[model samples]
Target chain A: MAELSVRHLLGIKDLTREDIELIFETADHFKEVINRPIKKVPSLRDITVANIFFENSTRTRLSFELAEKRLSADVVNFSAGQSSVKKGETLLDTVNNILSMKVDMVVMRHSSVGAPHFLSRHIKANIVNAGDGTHEHPTQALLDSFSIRERLGQVEGKKVCIFGDILHSRVALSNIFALQKQGAEVMVCGPATLLPKYIGELGVKVETDVRKALQWCDVANVLRIQLERQGGDIAYFPSLREYSQEFGIDKALLDSLDKEIVVMHPGPINRGVELASDVADSEQAIILDQVQNGVAVRMAVLYLLAQKG
Target chain B: MQQQVILGKELLQVTLRRLCQEILENHGDFSNSVLIGLQPRGIYLAKRIQQILKEDLGKDIPLGELDITFHRDDFRRRGTPLRANATNVPFLVEGKKVVLVDDVLFTGRSVRAALDAMTAFGRPEKVELLALIDRCYTRELPIEADYVGKEINSMISQKVNVQWEGVDGGEEDKVWLVLSENG
Candidate 1:
């Protein structure tokens, strides 16, 4: 299983256990490369990558750019805010224009679902879905699982609970798939209005109580309250103060647990809203490790896809 | 296929002793020099050399292991993607004399990739190569070994297997030459 089974990493749903394992194994090597005095490698020198983000992003964009530069790949960045998309250019037209410049790979993040999937059917270059709306964020799921495997030795049979905003989270959906594929138990905890109705069909346990979910799991991956993505008409919770009082993880809640569970968060955290500042900066939290692992994992994804190209 | 033992355990020991003495001639006391082994197979030879040097010199010298998976030229050209081994180069290579240890010197491609990989650490003052088995007259690149254990004249179709004790649960250290009939 030296090569990945799929060419484009559209979602974790398209990946097998072996594909994820291969990516993790390759990421272990890149992790070593980044830690060295000279962090760059010339593996992708002959290839060019175009990171086309249809949505605004700071961390994912910078992480992808750093990964490309570390691999010595030529990079061209295109943002929808500044691009011709605002001038009524279609998604396909935008991508075709970038493809005309001889880009070997396209790392795209679109606000629409199935944007990368639709492009993969028509485009010639490799496609890596950075994040496609609320559909899936595959690399984020991979790095989360990798972080768990790094801290807990393995993902098999270990309990993991995803807390907060499960209704509109691509991270929650992807993590459920990735963790379940690796033989880990998953539970989603949030208000009933915030959790999707179809979450139970995905074979994950649902818990509304934060303490009960925390006590039952070995890892607690707290997600941010996506106010931007949440629709204006639907009130998922009563208020921010009420949501924090009910579901937010604080040090006192963590201290009440009989076991010391690992804490994680995919960033742009709302500080005191979902995760307390002390808990985010605590020794038990691996939020920083998740950020550092993002680059190596993205490097692994790009390097493997470049092999297929 | 035809198989033959090119170097037995006793003869391999004698050859290693001579190679160590030659290294001592060039790098006395090994104060400013380091031993770096290419990953996967080369590290076995490198570990053996380091062990013998430590026993003889009564001092532990610096040794590093470098993986060249990302530096290989045949990345997507090959049928299967290349898997990487752990690279454990803890010390900097800047301004220090370095010796790259490997079990066999083949088409000189691995050494070429190794030369490229070593630069990531730092620019070494000087560099040299040590090979336990030199498959002569088959190098595709303009590269040669600095220290050779034994030069065996063989066809490109012939395979050289250098076996070390305690590696893959093997009993003895021996080198075998297997000639494939297809070529």
Candidate 2:
């Protein structure tokens, strides 16, 4: 019953049910603000947010930038390739340099897991984890929840199937935790070698066959095959064509399921590999909904974290 | 805040019921009457009025909600843009007697903004304004509510906030005014 104030958003596991609901409610308020002719607010006036990204990103970085600017806060983009992070500068020292300029918040995306956790302890300003390697992308999970809740009215009791390479996807990990926390039954489907061992310990159902997993779920969230992050023998499958034929969600597969079952994909979609182009563009697909909800969810996060209380 | 408190919690409720009765008596046909509540508090008040009409006069009036923040002239000053809420009325507004509801009638700026916002949806036959409390000062525009709970004389520096259990639960129906330090 206490007033909600989110200082830092490092992971989905750090948020409670009430905290999630508050984010949704705050997003509902921001929804009205967005529909206005002059789409802006002065809530975070005089506040400066630094986006420190050490990895290649488009959606996550743009979302954080848009969210900060919408709140009328000054935004600064810091790239690892262009900055001292490439010249053997310590992470703490880089953060300290920005803090010296009186930054209010830091939204970071790093290739290493636990990077945000490491920064949270040292930084005085609020820290938002845009993505920290393959560990957890909490905001992505929140935006997914917002999209699902917007379409289905509620996430509780809904069956959600997360398909594709679960080993290297931070999105799959975050969605599994967030969806389960919201009372949705989560099922991850992928090749045996592509899935993590002991995934069930995270309270999710794991399966190797995509067809069987697609039968009972209300939503199918297909994750992109992270080819860039594959450092080991993760690609146990024969080829992209073989993977598509075996586990790809197509129109034929979608026809067998209930009409209400929705399709989703965190994009830069692999076309014919993990999901067919037709399925991604179908009416049942909420890919654009996820993008739009990203703004609302990020607004909720910034509002909750920036509150003085 | 050192402003005149014209209406308390008890008086506000009584006046709301009286306003409902007057609307029903004057516009008794109830054929094409729809109450559109503004976002946040107006939505709650519209529901209350709808319930009153249904209970007292045995008329089931249609209700809807309008979010006028986007149409506001002063949005650039308020920090952070918000998302739009569902304006859930499927019926046509053409030639319907639409009543706009709000919690407090301030500089009449919000109501003026609401009127401008409603035109894009459809043209109404007539539009009426209703408020829980009407402070009769700092009027930048020539606008007055058809139904008002109470009228108070106050300065622009004072802040008046009306909270309800329907919206801000646990501690509802509380009215507070904060005076500006400059005053």
Candidate 3:
């Protein structure tokens, strides 16, 4: 009886350690199935999943669509760019209208924070938060944790340092909750002004220095500095040049560590900013592995949610 | 808690040897036959038989594992997520005879699911059911094992516990008849 109690996967904040483990356990099976000659399963044949992305994304949307297709679920992709969302329809009316056609599950990415959480309360269908406005990306955190678990043998007691934009990045918050829940120590590394005021209360160790954080952790998940979220003219830091000089992860900075450690990034990589192109493509980098695992992790989340309905 | 000892290691060894020899009579080299262990439990028995074929009889057999957790008819009715195991059937079953190995043949629901799960890879030339313990006349479905070690008259409440030395904590092979709630 490894069923998760939640109707929606809104965030890691709402999921217990057991829910996370069950998702991983189920993901293990999906991982094997995807590698087979016939990379499809009949598990969710009758279930239809809708990918509703109000935000622009390439990797998360495609990975989720593939995951649904692999599970044999009929998928309908939606975006605000081409939908009634551009017209005058509200989020509730739009989702309910989609559900009127009986979309069993929705994997949504929205610009607004807590959009998935808001929709889950209003709709009967299961909602999975792909990414919300700096709130949480549960699946990203899950895959990041899953990747770390695969590399380090276990998530428990392993030190994970999440660097880059801490305040504006949903992945950083979700990883903190997920890694902490699974018995991993969390350290957040970024510019002092860029981190959130709530960081002090999140029970995570804050190290503004990336070099020191790298020395102190097992795996360093270097987050992409959210360029879109940052205003064009607004000065969060002195400049990108100063920010990179102090906080950016280059090969030289990574080499300063006692031993070469695992480096990760949630994709659409800033080749020269948060992580260097050399370090991003290095042997220790698991960026590609994270992309490959995203499909398996999403499949597990969707399958578990479908079982409840 | 009162029960009867169905088969000890000595008796069970003789029965399994006869069963493997019976398989050898029909499936000589087992080149065309593939042995599939049902998920979690049947795997041990499948491994045991495969070991005997390789060690004692010098027949190298192709062994695979099949997990029917998803193909189950009662999947929706069950409370928990069907914690899936690996289904490692690398070879195509298109023309191969599949020996579906399981521990106990009771209701035959698992065998039915295994048949459904096996079709995902390819349709087999033939399929055979092998059970370590067959509770005769207790099947909900009209199913019978072709290679049954022992036929015991077991109540719905009485469970047949088969322990292999490699898997369980027991020293040797053993079978125990224990009572359930309905007993």
Candidate 4:
């Protein structure tokens, strides 16, 4: 089981529990490499990776870039906003053009669902989906689970609740699938309008009440409200103040709990909205750790995928 | 398959003691030298060397474990991907003498990778190799051991196996040469 079960990491659903564990094991090694003084490896020196992003991203883009650089892989960054995508260039044409330059792997983030899957069908190079539309962000889910396992020892048989906007968050969906596969009890907590009707069929417990959801789980992974992704005209809730009063996680709320539930967030956090500023900077929050683990996890993903013959 | 014992428990004990004596002769007091074990199998022999050295010196010496999975040249050549182990080089190796310990020295590729992996810690003033079993006439590189316990000529199809006590239910430590019929 040294190699990953799958060739590409398009989504969490495509990964088995063993594959996830293997990634974690590899990530454990990369984590040590990154913490060292040199903080680099020559594993991918002969390989070239193209990071094609069709959507705007800050942390994920930088994290993937850092991961590639740390592995000593030659990197070419392509952002849709600055590319010929503005001139109506098709996805296939853009990728094929990159492949013509002898790229070995493509790490893409597109606004359309299954964009990487679509590319995999036509392209010869390996594809890693950073995020596709509101679909799956596999690396985020992996780093989150890795952070949880780092904090609490193991993910098996643990109660984990994903709190906040569920209908539009790829993090929530991937977390549910990854946690469930790893034998953790999952619960999704959010406003009813934000939680999709099909969520229950995924075998995760659904709760609209935030306090009860927090009380019932060992970990609370809070997500930001995807206001941009949400149709601008439609409002999921009445206002920000009311939503914060009902859903925002503050230090006082955490202090009220009988047990300390490890809090996590996939940044950039909407400060004072889903999570309070105090809680975000609190020692209990693993937000910074998740960000740091993102690079190691992505390095593990790239290093493993490049090994596919 | 055929198996032949190269070194039994008593011979191993004497070899380890002799290796420690040579180490103490070269690195007096061990204040400026560090022992580094290559990961997976080398750590066992390294621990034995460290223990024997400590018994003679009356103090503990710095030891570290290095994993060269990422530094290997055969990243995508093998059928199975390489898995990494933990590398706990807690102290800096800057301007320090490093002694790399391993259970067996076959093709010198792993030693080459270990040299590359050591750069992350810092530059070493000098480097030396220590192997309990040196598989003769099989080195793919121009690498030689400074402290050698025993040397044996083996075929490509024959594998050198080192079994430590309390590991894999073995009652005592032994080195065996395993010969397969195909080769």
Which portions of model 1 show Cα errors greater than 4 Å?
B181-183
Provide per-model DockQ scores. Answer: 0.81, 0.12, 0.50, 0.86
Task: Show where candidate 4 strays beyond 4 Å.
Answer: B181-183
**Model 4 Cα lDDT, one tens digit per residue, B60-158:** 889999999999999899877778899999999999999999999999999999999999999999999999999999999999999999999999778
| Top-DockQ candidate index | 4
Q: Which of 3 and 4 is ahead in DockQ?
A: 4
Q: What DockQ class does candidate 2 belong to?
A: incorrect
For model 2, residues B1-183, the per-residue Cα lDDT tens digits are: 254345567776787789898788767868878898988678887888898889976767888787765456654344554444555554657788998898889889889878876775578999999987787877889999998876766678777777666564625565666556454
> What lDDT is reached at residue A109 by model 1?
97
From the highest TM-score down, the ranking of the candidates is 4, 1, 3, 2
True lDDT of residue A144, candidate 4: 96
After superposing candidate 3 on the true structure, give the runs of residues whose Cα lies further than 4 Å from its correct spot. Answer: B1-8, B90-95, B119-125, B135-144, B152-160, B166-172, B176-183
Interface RMSD of each: 1.0, 7.9, 1.9, 1.0
The Cα local distance difference test for each model comes to 0.94, 0.80, 0.88, 0.93
Model 3, span A1-309: residue lDDT tens: 578879899999999999999999889888877877668877788888999999999999999999999988999999999999888999999999999998999999998998998999899999999999878999999999999998889999999998888888999989999999999999988887778877968889988878889999999999888777676676677767777788888888888778878999998888888888889889999999999999999999998898888
Q: Can you write out model 3's per-residue Cα lDDT over B75-154, one digit (the tens) per residue?
A: 55666556788888878888999899999999999998899888877888999999999998889887889999998898
Q: After superposition, how far is residue A30 of candidate 3 from its true place, in Å?
A: 1.7
RMSD of 1: 1.3
> Per-residue lDDT for A7-51 in model 2, tens only?
788998888888788788778767655554445665566678899
Error of 4 at B163 (Å): 0.9
